[model samples]
Target: MFLPTTIEEVKKLGWKELDVILVTGDAYVDHPSFGVALIGHYLVSKGFKVGIIAQPDWKSEKDITRLGRPKLFFGISAGNVDSMVSNYTASMKKRKIDEYSSGGIAGKRPDRAVIVYSNLVRRFFPDVPIVIGGLESSLRRFVHYDWWSDRIRKSILVDAKADLLVYGMGEKTVLEIAQILSRTRDIEKCKTIRGVVWWSSKKPIDCHELPSFDEICLDKTKYAESTRLQTILTDPFKNIVLCQRQDSRYIIQNPPQLPLEQEEIDNLYLLPFERKTHPFYEKIGYVPALDMIQFSITCVRGCFGSCSFCALTQHQTTHVVSRSVDSILEEVRILTKHPDFHGIITDVGGPTANMYGSSCFVRETKGQCEKFCLHPKSCVNAKTNHERYLELLDKVRTINGIKHVFVSSGIRHDLVLNDPHGDLFIKKLIDFTPGQLKLAPEHSHPKVLALMRKPSVELFLEFKEKFEKYAKNSGKQRYVVGYFIVAHPGEGKRENEHLRKFIEEKLNYHPQQIQIFTPSPGTVSTAMYYSEIDPFTKEKVFVERSLKLRNAAKANLMSLNSAR
Candidate 1:
């Protein structure tokens, strides 16, 4: 059921007051894919009267107060994507549309939506506890660089003046916090919870102290060192409390919550969601974001691929947690019964489609592995297989109401190339996937790819050859599409030239999703972009900071196939 968005809905639920009120930048879409919906629905199932205020007007208290102040606290999220990334393009220009917003209109949310909403909530209800989470807060939980402002910023908890910040996938943290606050009604007491960050008058004992906010802003080397330390401390078990001083108080981030077990994640996905935007938003028109995922499925959480530019690892952790096949099949069955059912399932994958059932056995036995599973090279301890996922796809296809099931989320080509039964897997994918398969071979230049923590281009080329051969043998004329990033930390005009040449000469295709790198917070690539040095080796790396140079790099790729 959709959480109460208006006083009328709240009344209909027979609630005179709510225990929690969630404020988000996106329209209220009661789908599992949306954090607000999942969190809201989960809270409701737990017997808390939860209300959601979606895309509230930031200019005043009118919209925020619509659902009335919560008895426990206000949960503020900047929707699915970070506000800056959602509102502005990589070029720092205002975006024309917000997929998460109703009618696909932009500017529904402010630039720093979390901070804005938190501050707004504080203004009206100064005493109420305000907790911030979601992509914007999780990524910037510590002192990090802000791309839009082109400068170092204090931890989001400090800037937003929020009482507590829930980092990572926040289900466990939020539930714990809500439970604690319900009994104690003390925000300060919620500090010890894993996956929660808060400001402290004094630093906690035996914590990892990062460089002070002022020091990181002034010293690039210190910034790099801090970034390296932060990444190392993301392990749920080994991670100690991380404290960074912002002036007088210290921002204390507790260790991340352990990755949800399979049953736990499945339960979260299985929550009773309406799977559509709240009817209140129907007047504005259907949300564009829901159109894509309404029929899609999320089979996994977390990622093994530790791409430097991606935030999946930092937020969801490098460890993978997958749902059971029966649970996934149940969701598919429900989707097929929907009135808008088209007999087509958009996707069935997670961080990386093929990494579905694969996990590091060492993590299960010991604890969080310090190094990533598939960065410098694929870890031998990491269980790399596609059989379970392939079997799941076959089961989904055989369901009574299902027709075409595409793995539209894309696969890790390297995983497919390395699998012992990869030949059969590729043939299955050729039959299951749509006309074109999506893959991200960010750059061809070895140094560039190395900085991004991606496999070498040769691996991708080998996979392409094998996939094409398999497709041809199967009488399929399918093609592979690639996602590349320009002006990434190490990529200069020279690297871009090499990338262009490789695509034309070797791959014999022009890339379509070529994007200029946007330095998002809490990412290794963003740290490198800010420090102009590789975090691993502390070696000076070429960084293209000039807007014209960045645009030129993108234009170079854009020119390809224009005249073809």
Candidate 2:
């Protein structure tokens, strides 16, 4: 059943008032892939009356006040993707289509939707506690870089005037906040919860203090230092509290919530998701995002790959978690029985496909390592075996109504090279891929790859040879599609030319997956872009600030000869 969006629906459920109301920037789709839906369902399972108001008209009080006000709090999310990224392109151009909106229409959600929605709620309710979360709030919980305004902005919690901010995958943190508010109606009690950030007039004690907002704004070196500290201290087991002063108040961030265990994640996915777009959007048109994943299954959550440009490190954390094989197979059977079900499964993986059951024993016993697991070299403590994933795939293929099960998510090629049974895994993966496999090598030059924290291109070449050999033995016409980034930090004209020549001579095909580097908030790459200095090494780096040069580099790579 869909969550009540109007007062009539609430009355039909025999509820006088809801305990929580969720406001999102995207059209409501009651699917697990949608963050607001997943969170709403989880909250409902905990015996709380929950309602949702999606993409409310920010200019007025009509949609925002339709459900009245909740008893506990108003949960604000910017939807599946960050609002700014959803509304604009890498070139800072206004986007014309929003896949998450009704009929793929744009302009439904305002830029900085979280801040706008929070302000809208406050204008009406005036007294209700507002808690902000999701990708946009999660990454902006600190004073970080903003590419759109081309300046540093305060932590979004302060700008939104929210009572509290929940970061990371917020299932655990948000529940705690809701319970505390229900019991005492005191926002102060939620300050110590893991994965939460709140403002305080007094400075916190025994916490790692980052550079003040004024200091970071004045000194680029301090900004780089703050970014480095936040990146390395994300381990929940370490119990690290972060504090940064923004004016008279201090924003106190508690340690991240512990990564969910296998059983916990399985139960969360097994919630009674309707797996359909809400009837409210019927007249508006079909949502494009739902169509892509209606038949897909999310078999995993969280990623361990700590790429510099990727926000998964901040939003999902570096802890890899997977659902049980039984749980996944059960979901697959359910998908087969859906009204829109066909024989084909579009995808069955998470952030990285092949890292389904991967883990690090040392980190489990100790804490996060200073070095990344698969960056410069694979860590000795890391387990790179793919046996469990291969077993799951083999079992899934035997289901009664299943025809084709595809692994559509991008796989970390470095992990595949390190796995003992990688060759067999590659042979199996070919049967599922729809003619093209997605691989992100990022760049061909070593200096550029180092700045991006990706593995060397030599590893990519080695994996390409093995993939071709396997495809030939299976007698299938398959190809390896590469994703690259142009105009990233440390990429000068010489580096760009080197990558272009390598793409022409080595891959010998026109690349369609190239993107210009976008300096989003809370990423090491963005720190380098703003500071023009590498955070880890403290060395000066070259940054292309001109919009024309960045576009020219991408065009140069795209116009390569397809001599395959």
Candidate 3:
């Protein structure tokens, strides 16, 4: 990159000018991921100038050219999980569509966007640098085992053309990068960031000794090549590898964080976070911000459910943790002060809807937690606490200017049933939710629920019945909808027929809000599709997901015989 020849001569830097620029594919408004507004607040608290370029029309050749360069690093993204099925022709069309047809791939190629931005700055001013972070950069850290494409793809570092690829939990990584830059350290020279996948000093760095997440699953058949997959590819793991292109084929990789102590995870998120949650922007056709900010917060990290088809515990590491209630309530008090803020607090709780102050970490050791917390099945030592959640809810509900406090996030049936307080939590949720009650009973079959590490449909229904009765006796019939997945590779016609009958018999032929399993990367179910094996029981499963059945299920859900 050419050194900026004119920055010294033409510009005087101000705090705002020196601020970091966050450009993301996801709408920055209240986004749960980047929580750009929130992150921006933290940066400002740390005294870094920050700006956001949300969902840019990168289809234009000049998209980055016009932004010029940031005196600080540029944060780039294209929404949470960059691999979106672009064209909106039909829900089923995501499969039939390719990049040419899928507008999702049309945006600025990461490498090109980063390189051009850096280069353009070099041309005019020359010495400025650009760094890329976000899902697009994180997921691209390795020559990934792409089960869908059936091959390892190039690292995103090579594609996005950024100096480095910031992977995994970026909160600490991004800050350290700025410190290095502030010390005039050549970014390319800084190779030790915990989550960095970078070019190793003129040579491709190699990590022969690094751990592989491929081992996380106890089952080997995920590689069987028979199972159809949808949605996610592997459970979240710290195993990441980076190729060094500067010289020889050197590489860098990292093992996932040792299961974090509960206190560590809690303290990590509790750090004086400046509230950056977005105020809703009433823009039409614009990407909606993640809606990260809420009247209340829950589950800072850790979920130990560890289902073969899930990554909730994998991604965050299943050691359920939470932030201090004092910090969270403080944000509500501050947000309520805004005259425009609704007297009715919007967004009460989540990150699994109600997993606050959970997780059993060993003060004695990082001791990977035992599963079945609050379960009669096994974990006699499980650390279960629904009162913590209830306490948080009560505090938020009682906060002044807050009227209706709801659990806007989908419910975790496992956790809900574990604590009687969970039942109370749901009761309060129903009584308070002015909008909708969302729950995910992902499938109807007992076997499928077991495979997904979720509760059985019967169990979900039992809970639903209880909630319904509570609401009815009290004279409230707001809706509590279940999210179901169809066409999962393991689900075949016969299994689906059974599912339909089950729904019809139990749910009165009511169709659900159907979601065709679109196996995404970074998920356990995705691996099963790639290999067609149940990592747990060594059982073989189907590999293909049924779009037709899925569509029919959805069509059935939205219609009522009375409406017809």
Candidate 4:
């Protein structure tokens, strides 16, 4: 059932007051992929009365105060993606539309919606506890670089004046916070909750103190140093409480909560979701983002690739957690029974499709900060196997009333290359791909790939050869689509030219769409974009600063010979 969004809906629930009110930038989508809906659904399952205020009008207190007051706290999320990144393009120009909004319209939510909503709630209900989560808060939990302003900004917790900032996959942490606050009705006492960052003037004895916000702002290198420290402390097993002084008070981030186990993840996914936008938006229009994933299933929660430009490393963490096959099949049965079932399953993957059931043997013991599992080289301990995933796909294919089970989510080609049984996996993948199999090779130039922490281009070439050989043998007319990013840090005229040449000469394909590197908050690439120095090596790196140059590089890549 959908959560109450209006006073009338709340009255239908026969509740005069709600335990929690979730405010999000995106229109309310009750799919597991949507953060606001997932959190709201989970809270309801735990017996808390929840209401949603999605895309509330930030211009006035009317929309913010429409839900009345919550008994516990106000949960604010900037939807699935960061609001600034959502509202603007990589070049910092305002975007024309938001895919998450109804009818695919723009300006539904304000820029920096988390801070905006939190401030709005604080204004109307001065003493109510405000808790912020989702990508905006998680990635901005530390003092980090801001691409829009081209400078360092304080943690979102400090800017929003939120009572608590839940970072990482926050299901466990949020539930604990809610339970504690439900009894105490105090926000300050809710500190020290795992996976949450709260403001505290008193420094704990064992906490790791990051550079002061002022120091990082004055010195770019200090900012880099703080980021390096922050990355190392992402492990849930051995992480220390991290404290960074924003102004007078310090932002104290507790140790991350361990990712949910297989059973827990299965239970979470099994929760009943309306799996569509709320009916209130019927007059407004349909959400394009919801349409894409409405028939899709998310089989995993986190990414292990840890790409330099991606924020998954911070928000979803480096740990790989997956659901049970039985649970996945159960969800598939539910999907098959859906009224809109079209005899096809859109996707059955997560951050990376092939990373399901893949993990390091010592993940619980040592932690994930040693080095990347895929980049440089696949770690010896990294279980790079596709048998389980292939098995899951095969089982789903034979289910009654399912015609085709395509993997829309992009799988890592490197992991596929590492798999000893990769040949069979590729053949099965070709049979399932709707048209073109998507691969994110990110860049073709070696120097650029190194900066992005992506695998070498040779791997991509080898994978392409294998995919073609398998596709030809299977007699299936399938294409291997590649995604590349231009103007990333360390990509200059020479690097861009090299990449373009390689795609034309070796790959023999022209990309229909190109992406300019967007340096969102709390990413290693964003830090490099701001500091002009690699965080790990502290060595100077080249950065393409001109928007014209970035756009020119993108145009050059796409203008390559179309059907070579």
Root-mean-square deviation (CA) per prediction: 1.2, 1.3, 6.9, 1.3
For model 3, the superposed segments whose C-alpha errors exceed 4 Å read 1-16, 30-33, 57-62, 83-130, 145-152, 199-251, 255-302, 307-314, 362-378, 420-429, 535-538, 545-564
Better of 3 and 4 by TM-score: 4
- Per-candidate clashes come to 0, 0, 62, 0
* Tens-digit lDDT track of model 3 for 315-430: 44454546677766765676677554566555555456565665554511344433334322325444556667667777887888877666665556666776656667667667
| 2 versus 3: better TM-score goes to | 2
Considering summed lDDT, which 10 consecutive residues are worst modelled in model 1? Answer: 364-373
Q: Write the per-residue lDDT of candidate 2 for residues 191-287, one digit (tens) a residue.
A: 8899999999998878899999999999998999998899888778789999999999998889999988899899899888888889999999999
Residue 73 in model 2: shift from native, Å? 0.3
Candidate 2 stretches with Cα past 4 Å from truth are 561-564
TM-score of every model versus the real structure: 0.98, 0.98, 0.75, 0.98
* Residue 29 displacement in candidate 2 (angstroms): 1.0
lDDT score, candidate 1: 0.87
Per-residue CA lDDT of candidate 4, range 406-469, in tens? 9999888888888888888988888878878888889888888987999998898888888878
Candidate No. with top lDDT: 2
